[model samples]
Target: MMRVGAVAAMLRAGAAVSLSEPELLGLAEHVRPGAVCFDIGAAYGMYTYPLARLAGPAGQVHSFEPLPVPYRILEAGWRAIGARNVRVTNAALSSSTGYQRLRLPYRFGLPIHGWAHLEEGLKHPGSSAAARIVEVPVYTVDRVCELRELPRVDFIKMDVEGYEAEVLKGAEWTIEQHRPALLLEIEDRHLGKYGRDSAEVAGSLLARGYRMHVWHRGRWNRADRVSTRWRNYLFVSWAAERRR
Candidate 1:
């Protein structure tokens, strides 16, 4: 028998229109005209649309969404807007190139696509959200850049649930080469599902000469504490910092 959420999802599967993108303060700061940007876990092209606008016609926005349903929606949304600068890919970014089980979790009998993740062992405590698994193609950020022959990368926004660390690992080469500003969504509850912690993720970037910052009071403030009220963090490399 199909789940209640699955039935509901099928009903809305053909809907190409995307919900309104949430207002994210400071997202425009990292993106610049003619810059190349990456939107990992780009569900329904929420950030992709805005990133493309900020990057302008000379810029490029590479969006990655692995799930079949969300991928379809994201593709349609971008196409509807005639976003010629945005390139949509139906794949997941990880530490290595391979296939992995993607967990699509539902809450209160409704599909919460943003909460979908790649961690199979994830257990959402105190939540009745059940997940259904699907195999997804995975590729490294380095591999994608090489395959695309990208000249440079300027900014990246990653929100792959608890898989941020794996994504960062795959993007090491790109980070070192381009020194692009990174905006990542990090939460302890999500990382704990994969037996990881926020410290480890922040440490990896910090060790790479990146300064962590959070958006507060309409500005980017240096994040002294790894964990902040806002789960999203901006990691600016020293090179980019110096240029700014």
Candidate 2:
């Protein structure tokens, strides 16, 4: 049976800031039974629960959330559903291991919970939306793997605002060693706010021999160029032996 309450309500409502059911379903297509998956920027466990279910009892799902509010909700939801294979971490993954300020903005008299980001600028700089700054622990994917003694990583789904490049930089070792499939969101405007660019992000992955594909309408389409419009992309490592 599914759990009840706010988390379940949110899941049932299917109200996610930048995620859609089709996208989530497409992501699940990449996961295999007993796979080890990482859910970065896992707000309220929206993708975490589904990922855990996909991974199955023998698999594991590590969910990372920096914001306290969402982290708590994520934890609660995980327990509510009795998901034994999901591990929740209240930290942000970045290019380095340390603490960083996360900017959160409010909208319609309430926090726009999912918009909180570590991109160095507020999404609504001069708008009426209230802003909250919080210092959250940060870890590199390499460090996380080492500390947790993770055996292997099969897939990673990241939606860290525009900090995707930085996160990838930190996960270089893990990516090289495990060659996990990647699902990331790329927004040129958001990257530009922090002196980064989408082209650079895509180029870095391509340099590592990962083929890029765009996710749309519940399917994967090969993308040779980066578009300005915000959307999720799937990067499959050439070294990956498993095929879908």
Listed per model in order, the count of residue pairs whose N, CA or C atoms clash below 3 Å is: 0, 0
User: Candidate 2: where is the Cα deviation over 4 Å?
Assistant: 1-19, 119-129, 228-230, 241-244
Q: Per-residue CA lDDT of candidate 2, range 78-181, in tens?
A: 88778888899999999898889988888766887766788443343334358888999999888989998999998999989888878998999999999999
Judged by lDDT against the true structure, how good is candidate 2? 0.79
Top lDDT prediction, candidate number:
1
Which window of ten consecutive residues has the lowest lDDT sum in model 1?
Answer: 1-10
Error of 2 at 116 (Å): 1.5
Tens-digit per-residue lDDT, 25-89, candidate 1: 46667787899999999887657766777787889999999999989988876666577888999
lDDT of each: 0.79, 0.79
